[model samples]
Target: MRVRHSTNLTRNGLTDWIVQRVSAVILAAYTLFIMAFFMCSVDVTYASWTGLFSNLWVKVFTLLTVFSIVAHAWIGMWTVFTDYVKSTAVRAFLQIGLFVILFFYFFTAVLAVWAV
Candidate 1:
């Protein structure tokens, strides 16, 4: 016999899935942009790096990339934990720990990008 889940998908879960897919698409485009930038700038000087980061559009795109990555990671990890971790206490602890680490990493990346 097949069984069904007790709980239906929550709004948060649906939103997360949508965000993850959207971000993945955006990241693919960003990858192409990076490749084109690298190919065009053969010299790879400090000025080239500064010029890329100094642009407002580049900065905004980078920030969106960072946010998307973090959201993707969080949603992916949460799914893993929910699926694989059986113990409630352990799951809760690991979820919180993962979230903290993800937040710190995202924050650091944002700060580094801003500082550039």
Candidate 2:
């Protein structure tokens, strides 16, 4: 007999696995890029920091990094919640709370990166 697995979030095991890996790569690349940028800069001034993010490409990359972070967190948290939290009510509450917090963070990053 084949065991069927289902999730309310529409992501299957394969999709979730792929998403997690892709997001991880993006996160790693973004971190390295940021570190390199900081390392190469001689003067770490507020103006220089702001100037780096003022570029269109940098803003877009930052948004993508924010998205990758949220996606990675969601998948990891979802797996943990499903695996360890046995109570339906408790799991649902935690999942909802996690989503709310993640969404808020994503939106905040967007506003911060794009605001002139």
Candidate 3:
């Protein structure tokens, strides 16, 4: 016997899929900029680091980077949780845990950058 599957995809799922791809592209561009900045700062010093962070453009870029990372990780984690976890309770718990960890790191990075 042969089985057939539905061809239609859920709207939310498709939205999430599109968002993930867009986020990936944004992340790629951001990563390249960060890599270039680091490479150019080979002779790094406290003053040099502070100077980079002190710029308004750099601060805005950092905020965008953090937002993109959080968004990408959230979507990726949600996909993993949905695919692998069979129980609803388990999936919810895992997602909550992931959010907590992500938020903590996000805030920490924000504070560190702001302090610079």
Say which candidate scores most in lDDT: 2
* Candidate 2 global Cα RMSD: 2.6
Predicted structure 3, TM vs. truth: 0.79
Poorest stretch of ten by lDDT in candidate 1: 1-10
Model 2 CA deviation exceeding 4 Å by range: 1-10
RMSD values for the candidates in order, in angstroms, are 4.0, 2.6, 5.7
Tens-digit lDDT track for model 2 on 1-116? 23224433344888888888998998999999999999999988999999898889999989998999998898898888888888878888998899999989999999899887
Query: Each candidate: how many clashes?
Result: 0, 0, 0
lDDT (Cα, tens digit) per residue for candidate 1, span 1-116: 22223221234667778888998988888899989999998798989989889998998898888888877777787778778877767877887898789789888988888893
The better-scoring model by lDDT among 1 and 3 is 1
Q: Model 1's lDDT to the true fold?
A: 0.78
Backbone clash pairs for candidate 2 read none
What's the best-to-worst order under lDDT? Answer: 2, 1, 3
The C-alpha stretches of model 3 lying farther than 4 A from their native spots are: 1-11
Better of 2 and 3 by lDDT: 2
What C-alpha lDDT does candidate 3 achieve relative to the native structure?
0.74
Please report the candidate that would top TM-score against the real structure: 2
